[model samples]
Target chain A: DAGVTQSPTHLIKTRGQQVTLRCSPISGHKSVSWYQQVLGQGPQFIFQYYEKEERGRGNFPDRFSARQFPNYSSELNVNALLLGDSALYLCASSFPSSRASDTQYFGPGTRLTVL
Target chain B: AQTVTQSQPEMSVQEAETVTLSCTYDTSESNYYLFWYKQPPSRQMILVIRQEAYKQQNATENRFSVNFQKAAKSFSLKISDSQLGDTAMYFCAFMKQGSGGGADGLTFGKGTHLIIQP
Candidate 1:
């Protein structure tokens, strides 16, 4: 079966522009989370939504926001992008019923470049 | 807050040799879970091995295993007979147990780059 899937594998935007990345979770998965990974650093959590509700949020700025759909798909939106915002945006999903610490599977990630 | 740590920035090992990546984490709660994730050049994060806080026996998955010390909050991954395909950035992660936080996902370490020489 297919694992997680992400759209717009790569994107380029200028400062102050907005971008939205999408992700489709594995079949039957109900939880989705977003992370931002700057070059040379590990991913930092952004937002997490489960069953279409905000389950958790990271220490990110107001420019970052996300929403999960009823079908378990998710979207991560960044507003007023800055050059420092250029990074890989990763989407991960998991099933809460049968959970493991790392059972969360990740998509290939969206490579965002801001000028 | 839970925090995972990986001290080694990079490591190299012969194709047939073995290598161990160290990971330690800090958590106030006693019950939790630890994980080792591998991210290749493709940038898709994959689970390598996992350890439950309460389990006494260390976890093993074929050539992959973990040295889990619940008391010390230490969890290290060991890879035997490394292969070129195993080269990736290794991240140590932690998830607090039953935190009711739902989908916070995992707290990851800075990660270590593992290179397998062929």
Candidate 2:
């Protein structure tokens, strides 16, 4: 089965511009989450969606938002981007069960460079 | 709130040798999950191993194993017979037990860069 996939592997944007990154979860997965990884740092959570519902959000500003589709695909949007927003955006997918063994699989991530 | 700490920023070991990466976390919740993820140059975050807080036994996958100490809040990864392919950034993460099936996402450490010398 295909793993989590991300689109526009590379992106270039300017300060105050807006950008959108896409993700397609693995088949049969229903939960999708977004994370941002700065160079030399671990990923920081952004937003998570399950069944098209917003389940959780991180400390990101209002400029960051995300939504999940019925097919379990997701889109992460950043508005009025800042140079600080330049980083790799990652998407993860997993089952929505409470099982302790459940694991979240990640994508290759989209590299966004804010000029 | 929870925080994960990886004190070793980088480690290098000869192939076929054993190497251990250290991680410590602070959390008030008793029921949670801990994970070790590997990120190669490809930048894909790969799951290495995981352990549930409630379980006394540690978690192991093939050549990778973890020494999970709940009392010390220390979770260390041991790579036995390490290979060059093990060269990558290893991250330690924490998650609440009922984090809505991980909807709350993971609390990750800054990561340790592991290099296996040939």
Candidate 3:
């Protein structure tokens, strides 16, 4: 079975520019969540989408937003990006919803660089 | 909000030896899940082991086992007979109960860089 897949493995963006990272969840998975991992730090939750609805969000700034598609694929959009936005954006998928202990499978992640 | 902490920023162990990585978390939710994920140079996060709050017995997988002290809110992972393949940044995570049978994305610690020598 194909696992979670993320697009644009690497991206380069300038400060103030916008970037969008994509993720296609595993087959039969309904929930997708995004995380940002800064260099040398563990990942921090960004946003979660289940059934095309936003379920939860983290302490990130307003520039970060995400949406889930009908097929469970997700897009994380960052507007007015800052230098601190340079990090790896990871997409993880699980079945049902976020409250369950369903194991989450993660993608390789998109490495975003801001200059 | 739940917070996870990995006190060791980095640790090194010789191959075939045992090494333990420490983690502590703070959460108000009585029942939740704790996870250990490994991310190598490739940046793909892989689940190592997980422990449910309700289960008193520690969870073990292969050579990986957790020293879970529920009362102390401490969850540590022990890797026996380590291999060079074990070299990676291991992150401890906590996930609380969200509505809807969904698995909440984890709140991760800063991570411990585990380096295994050949």
Candidate 4:
């Protein structure tokens, strides 16, 4: 079984631009979450979707948004990007049955560089 | 809001030696979870170990183990017989137990950089 997978391994965008990052969860997973990791720092939670419904959201600004599809795939969108937005965006997936204490498996992550 | 803190920014251990990474978190919830994740240069976040606040016994996975102190709100990782592959950035994370089986995203620390000397 493949782990979570992400698209556009790396990206470069100018300030004020918008970008979308995609993620495909494991075959049997139903929960997908997004996190942002700045250089030399640990990842910060962004949003989580379970069964195609938004479950939780972090302290990120309104510019950041995400949605999950029927197949449990997810996309993270960032609008009006600022240089501070440059970071590694990670996607994680977990089984819905063990939602409370399930271990989350993470993707390789998409590196976004805003200039 | 819960917060995870890793005081040591960097640490090094010789091959076959043992090393421990400390983590402290602040939370008001009685039931929660703690995790240790390893991020190599490849940027893949790998689950190292986890502990449930309700359990008194610590969690051990192969060469990795955790020292979970509920009273102190501390969860530390100890790696025995360390190998060169153990060199990576390790993060400590927390999650509160929510009702309705809803999943809450993790709250992570700044991370500790571990170097295994061969």
Which candidate should be chosen as best, given TM-score against the real structure?
A: 2
DockQ of each: 0.60, 0.76, 0.60, 0.63
State, as a TM-score between 0 and 1, how close model 1 is to the true structure. Answer: 0.96
* Cα lDDT tens digits for candidate 1, B6-88: 99999999998989999988888777778788999989999888777888999999999999888787888999989999999
lDDT of 3 by residue, A5-111 (tens): 99999999999999999999999988899999898788888888889998888889999999998988999999999999999999998885444436677999999
Q: CA RMSD for every model?
A: 1.4, 0.9, 1.6, 1.3
Q: What's the best-to-worst order under TM-score?
A: 2, 4, 1, 3
Top of the candidates by lDDT:
2
Q: List model 3 lDDT by residue over B8-71, tens digit each.
A: 9999989999999999999889888888999999889999998888899999999999999999
Order of models, best DockQ first: 2, 4, 3, 1
Model 1 interface Cα RMSD in Å: 2.5
Candidate 2: tens digits of C-alpha lDDT, residues B1-118: 9999999999999999999999999989988889999999999999999899999998999999999999999999999999999999999999887746765789999999999999
Q: Summarize candidate 1's per-residue lDDT along A1-115 as a digit string, tens digits.
A: 8999999999999999999999999998888889999998889989888789888888999999989887989999999999999999999888876545336788999999999
> Which residue pairs in model 2 clash with each other?
none
CAPRI band of model 2? medium
Model 3 alpha-carbon miss at residue A86, Å: 0.8
Question: What is the interface root-mean-square deviation of candidate 2?
Answer: 1.5
Better of 2 and 4 by TM-score: 2
**Model 2 CA deviation exceeding 4 Å by range:** none
Writing each residue's lDDT as its tens digit, candidate 2 over A9-114 gives 9999999999999999999888998999999999999998988999999999999988888899999999999999999999999886767435789999999999
